[model samples]
Target: MAVVEIYDTTLRDGSQGEGISFSAEDKVKIALKLDKMGFHYVEGGWPGSNPKDMAFFQRIKNHRLSHARIAAFGSTRKPGVPVQEDGNIQCILAAGVSVATIFGKSWDLHVTRALGTTLEENLAMIEESVGYLKSRGLTVIYDAEHFFDGFKANAEYALATLKAAVRGGADRLVLCDTNGGSLPEEIAAIIRRVRDDVPVVLGIHCHNDGELAVANTLAAVRAGATHVQGTINGYGERCGNANLCSVIPNLTLKYGHETIPRSSLAQLTDLSRYVSELANLHPNPHQPFVGSSAFAHKGGVHVSAILKDPRTYEHIDPALVGNRRRVLVSELSGLSNLFYKLKELNFNLDASREETRRFLEEIKELEHQGYMFEGAEGSFELLLRRAYDNYREPFKLESLRVIIELKENSPVYSEAIIKLTVGDQVVHTAAEGNGPVNALDNALRKALEVFYPDIRRMQLTDYKVRVLDEKDGTGAVVRVLIETGDGERSWGTVGVSTNIIEASWQALVDSIAYGLLKNNGR
Candidate 1:
């Protein structure tokens, strides 16, 4: 079996994605993670582009990478300038990398129209650029920009451009589907033809315009390519580049290719989340291998079978990708599903009776009012604890009230007052905020803090509101989900009501109360 090389460009091409920007610190962290994950090459960034890339190179210069070589990406030299004098080429050298990648126009239209250069000059551009990088004692990889479409337009000319790079002593020739419109069969055919003509090793770099970047890359590998280049989370221009989170495992497990170690595959899901959080990008729920909903089952039958044996519903054991199976609870849940959920919460269900049925009915009633327990396992656990007599209310809600006053010449303000009794003491507090929900949350925390001062350390990290019945407008039922973090652990709580403010207040109150209860071991 041939050894497959994984080239990760998450910090470079991935950063090209709109609204995606990574700090130098973030790039270094991600680079370290990818290196530990055993990627063969990590394209740090385009050193010639901006200060961030330059800073990234400077910061990571001294760190010891265990498995991956850090490659600096840039374009070929200008039409008239020598490669030695080109600023882009100089920056690549100054970046102090062992390997450098340069992209040159391969399409005839791009050469004659976009670049305003003749065909022969473009070929010279490729040759001279590669030759200059090699002379600088850097391993050069030539990226044949628009290679697929260029081949379709002018086969001989595109092949000639690649030959120029090979003759100029490029270490590897990377075929790029720049526009990402080529089919899998086209990629395979092109890879075969290119491999036959080039003496140097071949690699693939695919975009995701047609949503087939991963497919085309795999197809190319099957045909002959040895290196697969992609961004970690498919972050790139337009739709994005091929996702390495999906490709690496596919090639290693499905195709039996040797890339990352099998034992390290389990880190895929967590690594994906870690990178997403660092980038401040939300993880795509449907993304293969590492998405939150990748192996989640919500339907009754699906959950039942998954409970018996996960393979019955899962395509791959989620544990293999550092993720666990999640059985979702919703209107689609059945008795068996509810029983399984209760069991997971450490509840022993009465299988011979209708206990699960009663539980399902209660869930349905709560859901009808706007509550969604699926995402608030902490709240659900509390409910189960109460049902099984294992729960104790840490504090009591004596009273909660909202007061709103509006004057014709002034902005409206809302104030919430809460009176709560814990043990023998009663605490009251009033707070003002922009909205009724915010006011209530502030006052509630203020009241709680008199007794449980630790509540002050907890904060609402995220808030999501869903209207259960959209047609009803303001009268529509609303579900509020609140995520809370105390600088150590995070948990979610949910509440539902016809009024959005009420729903938010309920969730916020439950979140804080649950935190106190859990901390106090009640």
Candidate 2:
């Protein structure tokens, strides 16, 4: 089997994703991460298009890379411009990189409509641009823009365009699915035909518009493509690019191909979540393989069976990808969920099966009252530990009072008066904020600061309130979910009650306790 070189375009293509923007410093951080992961190539960005990317190349030169080569991306010289006079081509050379990748029009329609150039002229541009870079001692990777679509519209023209790149000494012809509409079978067929005719090394670059980018990439690999291009977390314009998070494992485990070394495979989940954090996007819970819930089992039957045999419900061992199995206790669960969760928490609940039955009924009743535990494992853990004889209380809330005052020309203000007992100490504090929730958070933290000053680092990253029954006209039960982060890691805690304020308090208290407990090793 041939080795497939992994090329990442995360810094450039991934920034094109909606709400995804990285500073020059952010690009450097991500570049170091990619290089450390042992990728073959990391395409930094288009130097000619933006100053941030241009700075990345200049700044990245000082650090020595161990594994990956940095590639600069650009388009071929403009339709009628000389390669020497093209500003974009000059930028690529100025970046001082070993590898240079340039995209050129492959589709006849793009040549006639988008570029307003003749087919023969486009071919000349591809040859001239590629030859110019290769002549300058740069390893040129020619991205055949829209190669698959071009093959469908005019197969002869597409093949001719690739042939032009080869004549110009392009090292690799990366077939691009720009419109991202092609399926896997179609991709495989096209790649096979291209290999039969085109003598150069072939590569694959696909978008996820059809939700088949990974599938198409794998299909191309099976058909003999030697290079694959993708972005981490599938971040890019539109539906995003091929997700290396999914493709890398699939190639390594399922296809017996290696992108990164077997040891680096464990870093896949952390890498995925790291990128998600830098992008400031929540990790998709349902994302395959690396998602938080990827190995989570909720149904009692599923969890019970997994304790017997993980392969009964799981396709691959979650630990293989640095993820762990999660048993979620919900209204849909049974005693097995509690047993699994309690054991993980190291709680020896010496209860008979009848007592376990009573506990299950209690959980069902609370869930019916809108207490959701799945997203609030911290709160659930506290509840579980409370059932044991050795469990110790962290702090006890004595009282809380919140006041909302509306002004004539300003926004409403809220103040919270709180009292708490930490061991034998009774503390009282008051704090004001812009909203009721913020005020409550401030008051609680102020009271706890004397005892646990590290609690000051807890930041409420997310808060969500769901109305369980909205028809009750201000008397409905609500569920409040809060996400807290302690500079390094984060967790979710939840509370439900008829009063939104009360529910918010429950989650806020749990968020603080969980942060202290986990970080301080309580």
Candidate 3:
């Protein structure tokens, strides 16, 4: 299989996305991660553009990478300026990276309107900038910015820019869809045309403005481009860059081309979510290959088929990408959904049993009352174990009361007094919190900590509320969902009631109970 070089730009172009900001340390950490994953190149950042990038290049030198070469990104020398004198060009040299990626204008419009330079001067800039980097013992990757649009506008001029880079001894000529508006067919056809004229190794860089960056890149590769450039999770400016999470798997699994090592494929999901964590952005659950919902089955018919053969509903075995298959149970589920869910929870109930049928109906009835178990698997597991395995509650709630007070010039005060029982002993506790839910949670924990010290490791990560009936206004039944994590793993539980406090208390109790159960290895 032909190998495609994987060039990641998460530290540079990815940070251009709104809401994404990677510090120098963060960039170094991500670079090390990519190296360990066997990416060919990691574009650190534009050293000329920011101090953080310069610091990243300096700090990354202390750590030796195994596979990926760090690449510094910048533009070509300014028009009419000496290549050695241009500050941006000099910064790439000063960054101490073995690879330098420099982009130059291929569009005549950008030359006249953006750079206000003559066409010949732009070509000179491209040639001189690449030559200087190469002379400094750097592997030069020349990015032909806006190559596709420029080729459509003037094919001869775009080809000329590539030829200039060739004259400067560029190691690779990367054709860029800078505006990200090209179709797959357009990319394939243009690469065919360019292949006949330019003699350097061809590469591809695409944006997702048309929602086809991945498609366009695949098209380019099939049409003869060897190098691939993208960002993790498609983080970039505007619509974002091509997502390597989707790209690499498509290349290796679909096209029989090699990218990162096949054994490292299982790390794809973790890497995607890890980058999203540092960016402080939520991972897209629907993203292909590596998302939580990519291999999830919910419908009755689908779950039935998946139990027999997962390929019936899933495109690929989710385990190949380190994601697990999830069968969701809800009002729309059939007996198959319940059976599959039970099997996952280590229960093997007969699907045809009368009690099993009754339990399925009960779950449907609960869902109709606004208790959604799909996002509350912790609650669902408890319900299942109780129904089939004769499970006992660890603690029984006796009563609870919440108080909220506000004064003229002071912060609002909230307190909760809770009473519960463990075995034959009754426990009473009082605690203060920021709100009614927090107060209830604190008091509950205070009451139960002595019996189950493991509860201290559990922390509430998310709480969500939804009004089930809007027409009733204040009298509407509300649903509360709470997500709790204990460092290593997380679970979600849900509750529904007309009284907000009651709903919150139910969810809070389930969250803690589920954590305890997991800790006990039950």
Top candidate on TM-score is 2
Error of 1 at 452 (Å): 4.3
lDDT of each: 0.87, 0.91, 0.94
Off by over 4 Å in 1: 404-412, 449-457, 486-489, 516-522
Clash totals, every prediction: 0, 0, 0
Worst 10 residues of 3 by lDDT: 341-350
lDDT of 1 by residue, 1-522 (tens): 578889999999998899898999999999999889888999999999999998999999879999989999999998988888899999999999999999999899999999998999999989999998998899998899999999999999999999999888999999999999999999999899988988889999999999999999999999999989998888899999989999988898788999877888999987898888787886787888898778878898998787788889887888888877777777788776777777776666684467667777887788666678877877877777777756667678888889998999998899998888878888888999887887988888877777788898899888899888889898888888998988776788998888877788778878987898777765
**Local accuracy of candidate 2 as per-residue lDDT tens digits, 237-277:** 99999999999999998888978888888888998888888
**Pairs that collide, model 1:** none
> Among all windows of ten consecutive residues in candidate 2, which has the lowest summed lDDT?
384-393
TM value for model 2? 0.98
For candidate 2, the lDDT comes to 0.91
Q: Model 3 scores what on Cα lDDT?
A: 0.94
Question: Which residue pairs come into collision in candidate 3?
Answer: none
lDDT of 3 by residue, 1-522 (tens): 789999999999999999999999999889999999999999999999999999999999999899999999999999889999999999999999999999999999999999999999999999999999999999999999999999999988999999999999999999999999999999999999888888888999999999999999999999999999999999999999999999999998899998999988989999998899889887898999998888878899999998998888888888877888999899889999998877887886788799999999999999999999988999999999888988889999888789999999999999999889899999988999999899998999888888899999999988999999899999999999999989888899999999999999889989998999999998
RMSD of each candidate relative to the true structure: 2.1, 1.3, 1.5
